[model samples]
Target: MALLREREWYAISLRPQGQHRRLRDAVTRAGGHLLALSPLRIVALDGADARSRLRDALAASRCVFTSPNAVTCAARLQALTTSRTIAVGAGTAAALRRHGIANAIAPDRMDSEGVLDLAELQAVAGQRIGLVSGEGGRGLIERSLRERGADVVRANVYRRDVAKFSPTALKRFDALPAATALFVTSAEALDAALGQLDGERRAKLLAFPTVVASERLREACVRSGFGRIVVAASAQPTDLVQAATTLV
Candidate 1:
């Protein structure tokens, strides 16, 4: 009890609804109160000829899905092909499994660098690759693959819009401590979450300790005026939970 009282037990995740369960469970098991502070919503985009475009692009030696949302969007946009596939993390790999992608593998480290480190991705001087992701992301992955002599094509399968919570919702959440640390996964979501707050509220949010998924996100937090930021080694929910447990 004394050890539990030494640190505030609240941990917040700013991801979408379908992305919450594992993190929530991890936080609860870690003796912390998990909160969902979603500031963005993912909407898959499909054009009239979306299916045809996806079919053409996915006709490759390998295909990479950047997120669970990427897999979700791709599943809706077109029929997944028989090409070898990869997911960026455990959450994403699970989503793929639910979607019947049984052979999918997520790297031990969940990030672009991890994806790039896969033995399968190396020594592909003339192979074709397709990346299914949201509008903007994985630029490094694409660039690195190109440099490695793979022909890579990309398709934006979804769009993420700002979450719309009523004033009542924000007011209710205010009852939770402003010093509640946030688990921020993306720079865009961080900006959106902070944008919803007033100057004072934003200040409070920044002053609260934050656990981010990457150094890039940490830099984004710094630019957005976040004061106390901890960069987790990976984007896994378990990593975030373990990080929260060790915090002061």
Candidate 2:
């Protein structure tokens, strides 16, 4: 697909529900239109058992937040304390700072492997570690902590649900212009969005130039038959938008 510089640049966001505002605003600022496609909904876990788990995790020696959503959901349940906090990336670290946890640290790489390479986690034998995240993701962090002889407490503060798109929304996606770039951050969200489309629509979307958040996601896009892929510097909205706009 060729990008006509004279035409308006467009970007398709596959972020979760209520999470497209920042990206949308960023795209607008760059003089590009954003096709917001929410394929997942973030549901906070507020049951009694979940609360108890969160409390225990918060009281641990070291606490790690998997994502910004995890930080938000955890903050809603209880006051954030100044425990030895680690965030998966700069965005999650910013979320921690917003909740009054200023000393939170994040790795430059902004991924699970990066978190494991931290000096604080290197000597974690017999230490109690708390993992705050959504359900069924970031298993590598939890499993690696245990292998390092740390007592890991997993607090599942939220869950991702597959969101339903309206018929109108589906039609809009099907009619997107060829100059549109697909911005994908989460492989799961991308899969959920692709699952909603018919074979023809799916193939058409796969042919569009895609901007992925990481090399891992680039590989996922490759396996999904995406012809052109660009890896963003980080999962941040600015980086994703910058990478997407570069194609034009």
Candidate 1 lDDT over 1-248, as tens digits, reads 11344445777788875568888887767667766778888888888655555675578888888998888888887667655988888888888888888898678878888899999999989988888888777788899999999988787888788896558656646666754668988888888888888887677677778898988788888888878888887888778766666564
lDDT of 2 by residue, 119-161 (tens): 9999899999999999998999999999999999999999999
TM-scores of the candidates are 0.88, 0.95
Worst 10 residues of 1 by lDDT: 1-10
RMSD of each: 2.7, 2.8
- Model 2 residue pairs with clashes: none
Candidate 1 wrongly placed segments (more than 4 Å): 1-8
